[model samples]
Target: MEFEVVVEGAAGALVAERAGAARVELVAALVDGGLTPSLGTVAAVLGALSATRVFPIVRPRGGDFVYDRYEAAAMEHDVRAFAAAGVHGVVVGALTPEGAVDRPLVRRLVAAAGGLPVTFHRAFDVAADPRAALEDLAGLGVARVLTSGQEAAAIDGAPLIADLVRRSAGRVAVMAGGGVRAEDAADLVAATGVEELHFSGMAAVPGPAVHRNPRVRMGGTAVPPEDERRVNDPVRIAAIMAAGRAGAARRARP
Candidate 1:
């Protein structure tokens, strides 16, 4: 099996690459569930990675997958920028107000990708119907879909993920993600039957400054400034990759 690690910046990408990750999903402000990374960050990450495929998230903001016209345009612009930066792929998804895949908008983004592969992000988890959404994305020629089967964690949603994988029938790859731990890698692969897995092997690290602010806050009520920043851990990533390999080996046995 292959592992795709979610990274916050170029530093995290480098760490994940060194840890044997096959792919890295670059993003900004992961505390907000990941917004689009800046063009400079994308370029730096691409420059640092040689073997690992870089797929930057194209989300303009957090909160909801429903995007306005302006937001959609911004996402398209970012997609074009990343493609120009020589990224391997892009993670993108947009939903209608009614929680359906926004196919028209997604088509625009995919076109702006300039022939690079696109992975429909977790917006699939919130789609009104996951099976229908998967078919729609396949029709759009999406290379893969990253989802946790609409549950809080991939293991918890393994049944749905397995069903989706069986239903896809190789039309589109289904990548299980969300709260994927190193210890559970084998079980998740066995249960979901996914050839690829996505996860944030993140651990909290203290900020650079020695002193800390007591009252100031950079994020909203959900994520506070003093919550300690999270970065990708190489040890955890390697462990997950090893476990996933073991699982894949098991599945390949006759």
Candidate 2:
């Protein structure tokens, strides 16, 4: 019944830890669905949190899951670096042109990770055949698979997620993620029999009013304002954690 928070920077990590997150999946450019965070950001988060484990995402870029040779090599290097930096684990994913798990690249990344566990990211949800992809990942000894059962929101994919959980049979951990809401935490857990849940738990807050060039945006119109930050909220995170634990308990009751 552990909660994993998806966070971008040190501030978000601290918020997650305060809300009882067992661990966090650290990344950058979360608006791009999370890119690799700099080592400096990782260090800052590691220095800030005492109890919560930091597992930084090793993604090279945010586009498609299918990566080129250079991108794959960079991912391996990042995994090894994160391992040396004392991260608990690394989150990563790769797919072939045919939309299947890239076993060769993933195997290399896992080897570079040394003793650290590796989590296959949501790219599993986009696989041509999720069931077969899961089998491939499990065979490669991937520690876990984060997916929404090929749906945009985990709640919508509960049935497929539950089926995956039953099929896993403890061979690999099946983590439910993707638009996971606090209100649905207990029901999602109870319905899917998933022990791990992942979500951003973020809220947009106005930042310091020290900006002069408001007209010049760092990103496009869709991106948050330059002075606004999207950060994890402690209240939402705690509620989800409490509800998830309760759900686990209820299911355990014979």
* lDDT: worst 10-residue window of model 2: 208-217
Prediction 2 TM-score vs. true: 0.97
Model 1 clashing residue pairs (backbone)? none
Model 2, 49-137: lDDT tens per residue? Answer: 99999999988887789998999888988988888988999999999989999999999998998968889999998899999998999
Q: After superposition, how far is residue 14 of candidate 2 from its true place, in Å?
A: 1.4
Please list the C-alpha lDDT of all candidates, in the order they appear: 0.90, 0.90
Error of 2 at 167 (Å): 0.9
TM-score of each: 0.96, 0.97
Give the per-residue lDDT of model 1 (tens digit) for 1-254. 78899998888998988887889999998887888999989888888888999999999888999998899989999999899889999999999999889999999988999889999999999999999999999999899999998999998999999999999999999999998998888888977789999998888887777788767776656784674778898888888888888878888788
